[model samples]
Target chain A: MNTMNNKKFMMIDGLPVAIEGEKNILDVIRKAGIDLPTLCYYSALSTYGACRMCVVEGKHGEIMASCSTPPRSGMEIKTNTPRLQKYRKMVLELMLADHCRDCTTCDKNFDCKLQELAQRFGLKKVRFEPYSIWDKTDNSSLAIFRDPNKCIICGDCVRMCSEIQNVGAIDFAHRGSKMEVTTAFNMPIAETNCVNCGQCAAICPTGAITVKNDLGPLWEDLHDPNVRVVAQIAPAVRVALGDEFDIPRGTNVMGKMVTALRRMGFDEVYDTATGADLTVIEEAREFIDRLENGGKLPLFTSCCPAWFRYAEINHPELYDNISSCKSPIEMLGSVIKERAKQQETGKKPKKTKVVAIAPCTAKKFEIKRDEMQYEGEPTVAHTITTIELANMIREAGLRFEDILPEAVDMPYGIASGAGIIFGVTGGVTEAVIRYVLGSSARDHIADISFTGVRGFDGLKEVKIPYKEQELSIAIVSGLKNAENLIQAIQSGEAHYDFVEVMACEGGCIAGAGQPFVLGRAKPERADGMYEADRLSNVKLSAENPVADALYTGLLAGDKAHHLLHYK
Target chain B: MDNKELYQQIDEIINAQSSEKPIVAILQDIQEVYRYLPREAFDYLSEKLGVSLAKIYSIATFYENFSLSPKGKYVIKICDGTACHVRKSIPILDALRKELGLSGEKNTTDDLMYTVETVSCLGACGLAPVLTVNDKVYPAMTPEKAIELLGELK
Candidate 1:
């Protein structure tokens, strides 16, 4: 061991562990493979010592929060002492006393961290008297649900919204026992400027915040014979759907997912990536036109529903700068409805139900927006999260791992590698670049891969040379970074020809509706998406034969102009 | 105050500070003008300060001094600290609440004449069982005395 820089060592449970300037004792202990229980401790967010679950005894028998306490040299720490265990048990007991212990009915029943910790610590009973203080459940938002009773006042949601997304739609209100995470004047989340990102729901330790369930209507539509329920699965969902099963994180279950959806009574299972391919074609054309002629420079990609809503509410002046293109799922819905109805009635579709399975809760709200509809009927009728889809699969008694993988339905199912990468940040820009360069001056570009735009960075800036002119592109994931970029653009400090923004940190793969992993699963999931792209036969959107056929045949002239583009 | 005048006052308060204080200061000033923090004021501050509505609202609600709803003309606060609790302050609080017709969670009356609230401590421990009506203290208050004071205010 190279103990180069005055590295201190600490004894944790009588084992000497070398600590190299770690922030806290808890982190050091965690590094040593001893996973101390934490309720209010999120690695990304600020260390909130509100919950005393991570309390450990020091050398002098002083109880301190390990998360907030710094590791000192020659310090003796006792993490799992009987006294500390008793203290932690009492804390959990008190937390449970006032909590709504309806575990069977809770949305986060199996996955809730609080419940898992309690079970792990062998808490058989809570001696404290049961009491209920809060009765209000704010289901005001289209996506998020807030039950104040289940809240442990962890402040994770508050911090995540404020710090990570820069949209503090909910925060700690009042003080002490009366304190709660609520909107202004206890206003419903819908009334406030909540973008329906559902990050709060994703970070919630309990069922205090959860994505609104739309499984009932979906199930009804699935069972209905009159309704031709067509399912469109987003690229991100495939990379994350395996987490719901015992499958490891970042496992691509695309074929199995399609087969599972088909078995769950979906009339047709289509890929949202096909829609993404169409998006690339349309957006690239728009970008090229804007570059050649005079239009909004640095056109922002209008895909991530959460980012779209944030821009609309927070920065309406820049709305014109956003590309007037519907998201991949929305485009797929339009295609399915138009084509399905045309095939059925020899005219425009009247009643083809398009359901999208996505790794996003914001898609639920996006589908309900007025802009998302055509002729007063919503293009996407229903949006279900990946977790809900997994539940449906489990409910249907389908063995996801045991079942053989199947191909997706044709026409709307064929997609290129460019489309699959749309699940991660900078994918839309890269795909558009590939399409634009591949279509025009193909021989000039030697390497088709645009490695500049790919990564898990909050903000990425890249300049690519196309023929004579250089295209300046910025890829931003997370709304906070987007906010900064917007400010920079406004101040004339930065300029770009195109910008790709995704509200979630790692784009759709790490969406709030995806399976909740404690640590970030963005890098792994992004790798999985990249692997899918690598295996894809068609690397460019312009080269997709299905898209070419669609453009030349069904989506010819005014049909593509209407169905593919949105204002 | 008129919207223009209120906004002007808010602007002056914001400009008066050398460095920006926490949002509580702005909220407190707005509350001072309208007797409570108004939605319009909150929205204006949010726009001017470039702070999210949720952040401002959180700060407004966290403090006991700032009220989101319209408060009564005369606010009454009864001390319920350890000293006053031992000195039988519960009877005084009950008397005031009954007289004001404010029970349960209803701290403010329908007429908006009086609002009764309990404080952990008014920092008047020597004068135990103390109550204040719009900054005017009434120490060593009996139930009858508290009722008489409220009746006189009415």
Candidate 2:
């Protein structure tokens, strides 16, 4: 594969750039600092090249899409010639003609790629009339909003959902002008087995698909002096929230985040990592019990809501294998609500609402689940994404970057390194491994990190010797990888003692509700999670005092079983 | 249909076409049994076959012959292919629709007696303008002739 003996060079915009092993001409040009406008092309997914904006002129003045074309040894590629400009402009104008341009009030107003491309291409006016039949918005889904009118029909969302996630909840329906990205029978997406992952929403370049922003309702609650609102920040959010404030990606902004939330009327703020510690301990217990007592092998971690739902509906037989423990968010939510009900915090509101901040869209729907609900009301009142928290921070006019560092409130704030690592893929397994092998097993802990169990890969496998048994583990992010692993297990091709499934590829850090990333938020955010873990004084979940107190105190007898475990 | 009975009927069709590779064959068999692809059938097939409902709907909608809604007892298909169009098939289709009180959107009549639809071709191009009633080809038809033919059928 290394054809390095003969060097290849491709001329992009008349500048000769050496191409090592780049797949497409677009990649070569992009590596040479050319930011080509593309709507349907994502490096994570297969090349669609339908947008036609990334067209480059060839040697014979032939136009070819740079995204789909392979880079030749000495290919002449002019990115921005007059003809290319004209074509790109026309493409923009055509897209604009039917684009439902209420740009000032669109969900993706400032963040839209289509809007930026329109501005970049300098589309003054559309030559063609608005020929599209305006469709009504689909607001049926609990987590996602679908406005078909604003869609440029970029297949990024389509590929992300179907190809990347292996959840074909939507696909190309009808033909020509009537064509649309729709669920079966043009039914409401909530009716389908969509899993509510929102990876499609993450990849959607336009506001056609967007995560449901619960900010307005949150604002109403914040304004109401009666309601005591508490916020729990996910470990993933701490690393990524800084992206919105330009405070460098992967920087832990938990302290500043706490200050911002308090300023914005949050009565208490806690870290979900402490809740994650509960999950690791409980899941590990469940796994060990199953291994000992002839229960289902390969106990699936149920921390990921999207993956949990995916298995619940699609592979119902695996229901027994999935861990009974609630996700970190739900576990914390239950504890917070239960505590609020037990201890009367001097009653103006009469009700305490736990508003969890997560780097997930599925978490929105996760809060609404009947199991997540305590009596009739949800344990978590509302689950807001990382971006929504940023919006609130911006609304409060707090200088997030310069805010004085503040600690998270009370007993729930503390979490171990193992818990913090739960933000990224393969982290849940790694954490469980660290828990099973005690904190003192430093050499074994170092060995686990090297044994293919701590990377951002969509699918990872590792085996560790424990007692008499060799505990085999498989960690998968993205539904496609999960689906593949499931098939292998079903076909007797694969066997594992444990499996961790995260619906979003590379886990919560690259979730749909997080900041839109062009490439996979791997090494950057994954490294950040690992770095945060390294800096934590306590390495194992067992070592965390907060978790230990929970195991001994609050979570005792039937109450712990009821609060932490979901039936 | 009730869930059990609906599932029962679809299960029979699936079992019949169990060895069949193409989903189209199963769809065709179901269409034969039910006269149109039921929305419920999509739900059943998608789950059983592991093919997406969106893709099933797409294939259903793509083919002009495949119908999503239930069809009428007397199904009238007027060919509007190149030869048929040149030979004035539109007037014949218009006459049938006008007589049956059917519009573009409303294909089936209120009485459930008639459904008038346009097709690309019947592959009987030598007949110039042609229309079919329940697959019985009527050759060289005019507006008056089409109306007369409908009257005879009624």
Task: Tell me how each candidate scores on DockQ against the true complex.
Answer: 0.71, 0.69
List model 1 lDDT by residue over A240-340, tens digit each: 98887878778899999888888888989998999999999898888888888889888999989999999989999988889988899988788887777
Candidate 2 all-Cα RMSD: 2.6
Highest-scoring model, TM-score = 2
**Per-model TM values vs. the true structure:** 0.94, 0.94
Chain B TM, every candidate = 0.91, 0.87
For the candidates in turn, chain A alone yields TM-scores of: 0.96, 0.97
Kindly list the interface RMSD, in angstroms, of each predicted candidate in the order they appear. 1.2, 1.1
Model 2 segments beyond 4 Å from truth?
Answer: A1-5, A345-350, B1-20, B121-126, B134-136, B151-154
- Model 2, residue A437: distance off in Å is 1.3
